[model samples]
Target chain A: MAHDIDTLSGTEVSRTSMPEEKRSDHALIEATKSGDEAAFGEIMDRYRSPITNYLYRFLNDYEEAVDLAQETFVRVYFAIDRYHTQFAFSTYIYRIATNLAISEIRRRKRRRLMSLTGLFQSEEDTQVEFQPPDTRKLQDTELVEDERSQIIARAIAALPEKYRIPVILRDIEGRSYDEIAEIMQLGLGTTKSRINRGRGLLKEKLQHYL
Target chain B: MSDEDLQNNEPVSRLLGELKHVEAPSDFDFGVRARIAAGRPAEKGGFRIPVWLAYGAPLALVLAVGGYFALNSFYSVGDANVPVVALNEKANVAAPIPAPSREVVSAPPVTKPDDQLVVKKPDVVSDSNVVAVKKPIAKDKNAGGGSIDLASRVGRRFHATPQIPAKTVLDLIGAKGSFEADGWRVQSTTPNSLAERSQIQTGDVIESVNGQTVTDKSTLRSNTPLKTVRVRRDGKSVDIVIKN
Candidate 1:
């Protein structure tokens, strides 16, 4: 198990501990390209949780987030040959995940537009459909935490997609502004502007929590 | 401070950062592996058709059917334009010379005296020779002199008046005659006509024109210019070349 600190943003680019393999993302991708299925599985193990979390915050639905995260890995696996190493693997994977999330959001909008239940409700109502069913009992503290989490999730989801993506990547995913710009295919100034606008919007909604 | 510094230090960013991170489900790796093993979704059912081909195939079929029928109707109209004979009481058989605005009467095929000269109608007719005939109408004796009424009366009389040795192929090709059974017995020729210029006299019986034997049912193609007239004169068949 080896660890590498990413200098640009102080995030961990390496796994916390894995006894069998500790290859870098580029090395693992090259191994996957050479028909190493285990290398691809390791790559999936490294990024899946973070990608799933990012999508969950973006969509405010756990099930859809998991589904899109899996789809992201599948897309990366099949299109690995076309993947250029000029961009970081994280940027490439995040971009794939972002596009998939946006597409899922649009699909949900179209479905809601056509459904009777969705016709009269505000855009906030779109979050309910793909929510993973939680049947387990919750203690008082956990319940309180869950309620606050839902409010924060809803506030983030309510932001317009342009602002939502950059805000989620910056604050929640801890991606640097340069990386966010690369993932969004936007200029640095525009990415910073959108992140500020998103924070302004979130500040109004989460004033109590702040 | 700059917007970037404010965005970085914002309390909203801290709150968002403090929120709980959602992890992928425990079976997530298994699910992805299973999906990869299954390959891309089976195209709904084994195969997929192109959207253009699906819609275009039916559209092309409709166009083909419509075009075939449209072309068929046009050919039918062209077939109707061909000259056909009208039946008469006497052996006076020839294509009906039409009156204006009248329905053309086409006859059943008539047998000729010389069976070799089939009396069936010609498949092509010149625009000048194309005529339409209608069933004869009773003349209105008390009709006033209005142009429409006058035309109706004239057409009625023209049909009612009995034909003498009826108009023959010779009549269509600039030779007006009371065509007898033997040949076209020349009644009269207009000045500078093919008959008159060919030296065909009133009494001379035309046996053939351009080597085709003349009969009551025999027809000369109106589109073709008359070349020579074979007439029986003084107990001899003489072929006379007609100048154009």
Candidate 2:
């Protein structure tokens, strides 16, 4: 019930009245460590969507990002014993999510290399052929804006991971520099710098369309 | 375009707005709660085994027994079994008959030389076919002549085997794995170029490229060599090509 109020939009909402909710992250963490499933669940319910969105933006693939987000929660759950109240709960969760994302990216890269070989071989042999679907008729009904969205998604994908992550967090997720730094475990200056650089890279890559 | 104009750009604003509406899956809350429930540890006052002793004592016993059996099995697997039996047999033979002292046995025997040399090396010494001399090494001048240092011999034997060099590739373009919070990551691979062609489907773990193990995406991008790539796909080995 307390989370219902906290979930409302705008910065002016008061947090002092909800005593149970007002309990510091440390209290919830201590309760969770003592086998209090409800407290743990409360934490999960509160953070899950934001964390999922964070990962989704970080990783363009919806399904994979969702899976990693779930794994991040699972890890957080299991590592509850190791949770120190010294750091913000957000930082801890973000660190776990970021690690999983990084691992997934590495795995994807390896797969891409293997797939590239298959592509080349298939191209040269021509025997292993895949027929292209007829797109002309479909294109007639599709909106021009929808096509533009597809192009933009591709352009975003084309940007290197370095530039991409900050852009997603800053622009797409609309997180402040302080939040981004905490999530990324970087200094405030570095976080801002990355956002700037990321935007520059995106602009340059998308300049052709612009 | 000016900074002011860019800030008010409709497309950018629209994109950001659209991104905000990207809701998590319907089961997201359920999944998270389930994980949290599963991960919650038992209460300290709750009826449960002590965490350390529960794991520690059994682990210690296992290591001790394991070490004993491992050493025992390693040494006892071969001719050691036969010698142990032969030693037991010799003890049985010596038990029944009192053997004469070495001084008396060494005295010039009235019997034939063959009968005098009855104290032969035990028949159980079948390991190397090298005869075991019962006398002290100082008395046996032939001991040093035929004996070889086992360590030096083994070392020399392996020295002849050629060492295989690890190969590496450079200048590959791909996402890097990092622990850093703000690191970039690949969101998805659209059906395209090197990624699609290489049969690198989603969720494949890239262990290395051209024999070079990559730590991060930058390392992967910079160190990817123009040659064959080695990757693990579905827990199996796969090779990919990198066109020069």
DockQ, prediction 2: 0.15
The alpha-carbon RMSD over the true interface for every model, in angstroms, is 3.5, 7.1
Question: By DockQ thresholds, what CAPRI class is model 1?
Answer: acceptable
Measured on C-alpha atoms, candidate 1 has an lDDT of 0.64
Candidate 2 local Cα displacement, residue B82, angstroms: 61
lDDT of 2 by residue, B1-244 (tens): 3445445343553454464334567797676666556655322223544546654666788799999989655533432101111111122122222223222122121323332222221212111111221212111221111111121122233433111111101111222222232222223332322333455545455544455443322211111123444656656867776321
Question: In order, what is each prediction's RMSD in angstroms?
Answer: 18.9, 30.9
Q: Give residue A117's lDDT in candidate 2 (0 to 100).
A: 62
For model 2, the stretches where C-alpha displacement exceeds 4 angstroms are A1-24, A116-149, A207-210, B1-18, B33-244
Cα lDDT for residue B126, model 1? Answer: 27
lDDT measured at residue B129 in model 2 versus the true structure, 0 to 100? 17
Error of 1 at B149 (Å): 40
How many Å off is the CA of B8 in candidate 1?
8.8
Per-residue lDDT of B152 in model 2: 16
